[model samples]
Target: MRPNARFTDVQPIGLDAVAAAAGTDPDVLRLENLDTDVPPPPAAVAATTQALASGEGNSWLPLTGLPVLCEAVAGELRSRTGLDYDPSRQVVITSGGTSAVMPVLLATTEPGETVALTDPTYAGLLQRVRLSGARPHFLPLRVEGGHWRLDRDALTQVTTAAALLLMSPSMPSGVLLDRDDWAAVAETCARTGAYLIYDAAMERLVYDGHPRINPCQVEGLAERTITIGSVSKEYRMIGWRIGWIAGPVDLMDRIRMAVIYNTTVSSGFAQLGAAAALTDPSGSGVDEAAAEYQRRHDTVIDQLAGLPVVRAAGGWSCLVNATALGLTAPELSSRLLRYGRVAATPMTAWGGTIAPDYVRLVYSREPVERLSDLRYRFDTALTSG
Candidate 1:
């Protein structure tokens, strides 16, 4: 947000800047994107192939979603939360998870309403809040005991929100909300009549045997919970760009209309592919992907052991405290790119709570072998004088 309403300038996202600077350099260790090199599930690929040949998902009639795909998402949620959502009236498809978020924001909040979100959240999500004309109230995450935690004090502020837009394994910081944290949020929402809008794109990408509890599982939260998920992060189907929004049937009507108005509908074949991935009893390969990502995460943290890197319990990236290292985030990022050939993003405008010296290093895109030399690169970069 601007310092004042009179100030209309908006901050540029750090990811795009790093991406443009990194370019197509084969030698530059590309740690600037949330992308994963892991391929999509075999079942999804096969289904997309079949859809292309037979044209099953080629229609524009059902803008909400394909009946099969909606059921698949409903079943997926049911398995995770043990709460049932009617596929027919509770799910709507979108061009992508990013696309789905805007409509959800639109549905849950109004112009000038407060939307509670974590500090250091996804830049895209923060931007969408501004686009939807809602004011953002950030609940800061603290790095305590070398791991990220939702500052228990921030939970009190949820009462002032029209909705709480959050993600477990939150991007950039990799802060995962545990059972107690979620219980507090659920209780607050129930007490204050605030909506719980969950961004579940990377819900399955946990590390080190951590337990992930859905907000729906927290007593009385199911009816107030709105989940937005996609195949992008967990399913490795970024190109497919398929996502869904599910919630109470009455709220779902407004959400469906918002999505329909905003994106018209998601791609037909991609929806079929996502359906196939979600329904495959064999699974969607998320566990294998998370394992690979954990290895990469470990290597980077290990290499930067003496540095100011915070451990990411889950998700694809972690933060480095540039201020503690005696440098601003952009300056550190520039040094890494120039001297170390490493592309890392500065967390400048992601949220108000991110300090001026925070830089994000993405581990999902690169292999562990390539990341083994992280220390050498960092030492070379930081000690360059």
Candidate 2:
């Protein structure tokens, strides 16, 4: 039997391929992943262990999520965005941020509808839209004076689109959409009667003292926006596989149904751990982690100075213009893996026709001390070429 036609041409460039090219584990100073070197918070670990021992997490939970976890997520959302949501109705705990996307897409849009996305977006999102039998329309971002800005005019042109998937403090480019950007998107969505799917996987990692902004907080957009968040990046709990989706109650009901028909439910113990992580009295180590990432960001940008690299305003990764080094992103990535033993992801995998000349380097994987080594590797790779 043949697989689905949507997946026929979807060959993702994953970290394993990069690791193979480097002939080493992807974890070894390999900057291909956003994984941090830090361990999980003590509270999260203890909560999960306690849950497993008490047998509270051994069985399936409600498809919407456990009550405690839902409340924890709702409360966190209220604290962050000044938006109140009913724990029982507006929030659904998901397996991960990636897992949350498909259900939302399936629940909101019909087959063959156009789903808009920023060019150079997360590749996984592009595939998910296709898997849902929806078409994708990319709105290319413009780089001006080192900042990546949204093309509002282009977005407004797509008046017939059904939904828009946005990652603020977006991946790879790491450009955080400012308030005006959010307003433009909200206006466009409102005008077109389109939904806004906000992927906030890296929401809390903003650097250079910039405050985090949520599009849902904008006037009139709350009811039309579905916000997806996870503890993976902020709390350093990537392995937990816990995340959440929050939206208007009526739409959330459909999403809950989708979750039931999809994964059924997320891991109970992982939800417990995630709840503890979100509600931890000690602030969950998020601030310290954000500070650490900011340091890594500054260090990496400084080390890669003189290269055609745009400084990342937020998020864990930044884009390097590989053309300056006389190589395409994939070519530069392969050469870097072979000579420098550094595994950087080519932008071809991240999607968009505009990304061919760029490579994405994740600084979150290596510690501050190892940054010097990363710098040296870059020097050798570029000079020797």
Top-TM-score candidate index = 1
Candidate 1 lDDT tens digits, 137-187: 888888898898987677775667788899998898888899899888887
Which prediction has the highest lDDT against the true structure? 1
The digit string of per-residue lDDT tens for model 2 on 180-284 reads 888988888888899999998888888888879888778767889999998888888899999899999889999988878888888999999999998999988
Over 4 Å off, model 1: 1-9
lDDT, candidates in the order shown: 0.87, 0.84
The TM-score that candidate 1 achieves is 0.96
